[model samples]
Target: ELKAHSEFRFESNTSLQLVLKRGTAEIFGTELAIDIPYNFNGVKLAVYTYHGAALEITGETIVEYTSEETPMPIYYNLHLALEQRRMLKKSPRILLIGSGRNTASKILANYAVRMGRSPLYIDLDVTNGSTLFPGTMNAFVLDKVVNVEEGCPSSTPLSYFYGQTSISTNMRLYKKIIAKMATVLYKKLEQDEALMDAGMIIIAPKWSDSVGFEILQHIIEAYQVTVVAVLGNERLYSEIIKKNKNEGVEVLKVPKSGGVIDRDVIYRRQEMSRQINRYFYKVDNEFTPYSLILNYKDVSVKKISEEFVAPTSALPIGATRIVDDIRVVDVEPSSAMNHMILALSACEQTEDEEAIAISNVFGYMCVTEIDDAKQRMTLLVPCYGKLPKPYILVGNMKWIDHQ
Candidate 1:
């Protein structure tokens, strides 16, 4: 039996699974399973059981009672506002911006699905790509409530490959991709009256907020955001309010969930690698991706990096070309791309920088082996013979092979 304001904290050791026998509890702002044993790695986090409850556990485990007040019931108001807008025949475009671990987008998404609105969800946080994998900009329309345990599906109607983890790595390319997506979304909104009426929900990256108000303003203008919700930080909310005052935009301040825990860079990278593996190998199916050996000479690769343009004497001009917003540099060390996730450029050839920059990726390829002696590389792709063009773009994305 659990008392009021009590929580059961799970220890990170041998696989620990919890079955909620009788009680109301949540993890990361999402409800826990009733009877099904949930395999949990609740490290440095606690599962708060509101009021009291009984839990059944399997395997060697440790659970401590640590109670704390959480901010979840208040977030329900955002969902209510959207529902109200829907009832009033208005499509409200909602955007959630905050740092990772806070799960700003995921929480709102769960609420949106629960409220029964098939909102178009756009994920702009390419670093982790919360719903999908990293290095991709994706969107989906949700019709039913997403399961708290299963999470959302990976495949979606709208997805564009950026081939990089963070937008900060290539600001110009990031903005260009955003522009293209905005255009596509605008056209889509024009065609589907129902979807347009349902409106769009975007989850911007935390880095965007830290960048400054200009970045936030750009995202707001780009997405034509109607509602801007800031979570966790009051200073950010106040700053956003001051910046968006009288701009015909409604800004709301929301509290961060108790379950939100920040993950380190290593953990995030591991998650990204898992996403890549999942893309190639399905969880519930037997599948083997086609592997190809391609000569390094056949494809042109552009690695996006900043180079110092101004010398010490030309200090006033600036240090790097990225200061001028340059996105990529022509790299010739083709063998070094081993284990890196590369995007197959859509262009017929990689000669045109413009085409490579703005064009969509044919697909992704993970470099498994590199032979400098043979001047060739072995790549694992989703399908056979779908590499499209010879121009492949490599980014700062790297994956650890679990084989």
Candidate 2:
């Protein structure tokens, strides 16, 4: 039972189902449809109530508790202000920057969808992709409230394979990819009035240091951010106010919820593993992916080589350095590729470097095995029938199935 002004926070590692028995409550801004069994798997979230509520919860949870203190009032009022802007048809591209674990942006995104607006959800944190895999950055159109049981939307999104779970792996490639993504997605905003009014909610990683803060500034320009919502961290918020130096964008400090817990590196790795499994097999195992065997002559596999670029000050005066960061070179399959994830590129051919690099992903597959002697490989794919394309892009990411 949850009393007025309190929220129930839970962390479940296994399958969990929650039912609202009485009164009214919501999860992440979307109100629960009473009597409906909402399923959760390997997720940490909260169910909050304005008045009071009783819940029927089943399955195991690692952590479960009630917090009387929360930042709901500040968040709800922010949502109301954002809704007002949407009503006036003034597009508000809100950038949510905070702790890596904060879900303030998601709450706002849910609020927008609940209000019948289809805001574009752009996720920049590759550690925990909201719409797709762990190492991908995607901009998904949340047209309707995400089904409570399914968790993530099944529809394919406009995605770029950053190839690394952490941006620190290849910051140049990460930045360039975001720039290209901006050019592609921003055009859609210019063409559709309704979508323009609906706008975007960009979720970014914490600005922990000088490098991260610089990247945040780059993102603000690339996404054409109109508003910046800093959650909880007062030092980070003050730094943005003094250093960001962008007067056109409105910045606000929103208190973080008491339920927000900092997840350690080990926990993040575990979540990434779960995300990979969820992508291929799904949360409930309702779908069965097929095993595809292809000869070396029929298919193409390419891998990106991560390159490091020196800072501008490191270079000599009046000299400019050029780096090929997006290059994907053909690689012969080896035993090392076992359990490696490959992005199914939308492009049919990989001959053009630029086209292959910029192509959006339609699906993903894992290289389960490679028979070097037979010159054939076995792939585990989530889609039915033949793959839409023959060209596949490989990155440094690998997933070892614990199950």
Top model number, lDDT: 2
Q: Which stretches of candidate 2 lie over 4 Å from their true place?
A: 100-102, 206-210, 309-322, 348-352, 401-403
- How many clashes in each candidate? 0, 0
- State residue 356's C-alpha deviation in candidate 1, in Å: 2.3
Candidate 1: tens digits of C-alpha lDDT, residues 1-403: 5555565654454555678888777654457767877763323345656567777777675544454555545655677777688778788888887643225555566666666656787887787776667878777776654434334444444766676776666666677777777887888888887777778778776555545565566778888889988877788888877778547689888877554557788777666665677676644324588889887777677765542344566565655432444455676645667798877766675455656666666667788898988988888887878465767777777775565
Candidate 2 weakest lDDT stretch, 10 residues: 146-155
**In model 1, where do residues sit more than 4 Å from their true spots?**
1-14, 20-34, 37-55, 59-68, 100-102, 144-152, 163-166, 208-210, 282-287, 307-333, 346-352
Q: Please give the TM-score that candidate 2 achieves against the real structure.
A: 0.92
Question: With candidate 2 superimposed using the best TM-score fit, by how many Å does residue 181's alpha carbon deviate from the native?
Answer: 1.4
lDDT of 2 by residue, 165-226 (tens): 77776777778878988998889888988888998989885455746787898999998898
Whole-model lDDT values for every prediction: 0.67, 0.81
